[model samples]
Target: MDARRQGIVEVAARLLRERGAAAVTIRAVAQEAGMQAPTIYRFFEDKDALLDAVAEHVFATYVAGKAQSAGDLDPVADLRAGWHTHVGFGLANGALFALLSDPARTRPSPAAEAGAAVLRARVHRVAAAGRLRVPEALAVELIRAAGTGVVLTLLDTPPEDRDPALAEEMLEAVLRTILHDAAPVPRDDATALAVAFRAVVPTLPTLTPGERSLLTEWLSR
Candidate 1:
């Protein structure tokens, strides 16, 4: 990224933290960055673009910290750690979190995709260990949805009225729904087969490249 563009994003992110999304005007960011409003246009198409860039910058930084903190412990424990980190981040950075969670965004930003990829890898580990009771994709979706929902709910509540255990309860509920008891017993279910196939899809040489791609897509569903 260009220095000027990065500078603008940094200023915009700070503004977002200081004031809410409604205050992140292009003119305000440009003024904070010691540049003209028109200069901001050279780097960003519009205020929405600029806000998206700010969201990307902030989220990427948070996810980087999350990656650094993650360790190769038990896969399930690692996933729990990820869940805690995600909720904590959302609570601390409410504006950036809300921007990333906006339903109107439609297409996800690169940072959002990177975060999802991290979760997918963690879920895949659970599946590979034969501990996932649900399809890997489904488990990822459930966890993502639950975590986001919990954060949003907490953000909406008065701090004093918030349930301290809400986040943990939601996480444990999802875990019970998606994880197996004991060591993964041999299961012949379709979901299990799909998850196991997805784990090794990259190494399947029996199928042609196009076939493998198609199969992988199908299994992901």
Candidate 2:
């Protein structure tokens, strides 16, 4: 990115932090960045474009910090740490979280995709460690869904009335659904057994491709 463009994004992001999304107008960003409002058009086509850039700039810094924090921790430990950090970040930045989660947006921002990539990498590590019960993709979606839901629900509640255990409990629930050491399935948990069996169907040498597919389809139902 050009230095001027990066500077604009940083300035916009700061405004978004100190104020809200409405504060990141092109004119405001240009003023903060020490440029004319018209000059912002050289980098961003419009206000929406500038906001998208601001979102990317802020989230990319967050993702970088998350990636850096991974050290000697095991895959599961690292995953938990990442989850806590994600929840905290979302709670701390309500405006950015709402902007990134906007369904009206035509598509995900580049930095949003980068954040997902970081989660995917962590889930992949768990899969590689043989500690993941569900497929990596499914596990990622479950965590993503749960984390987003948890944050939004908390944000909606009055802080005085919010349940302190909600986020932690949600994470544990998702972990149990996806991890190898999940709470044991009840003897009558046919659905749980089916899902577990479905995961190993491809490794069953005795089953032909067609048979595996059929079994997988049935289990998915």
Clashes of each: 0, 0
Q: Which stretches of candidate 1 lie over 4 Å from their true place?
A: 69-71, 186-190, 204-221
- TM-score, one value per model: 0.87, 0.77
TM-score of model number 2? 0.77
For 55-121, candidate 2 gives per-residue lDDT tens digits of: 8777877899888866558888999999999999898888899888888888688877888988887
* Residue 81 alpha-carbon offset, candidate 1, angstroms: 0.7
User: Which has the greatest TM-score?
Assistant: 1
lDDT of 1 by residue, 1-221 (tens): 99999999999999999898988998898889998899999999988888889888888877787666555778888899999989999999998889889998856777888899888888887887777877877899999999999999999998999999999999999999988764563566667667766777888778899999999899878
Each candidate: what lDDT? 0.86, 0.82
Worst 10-residue lDDT window, candidate 1: 181-190
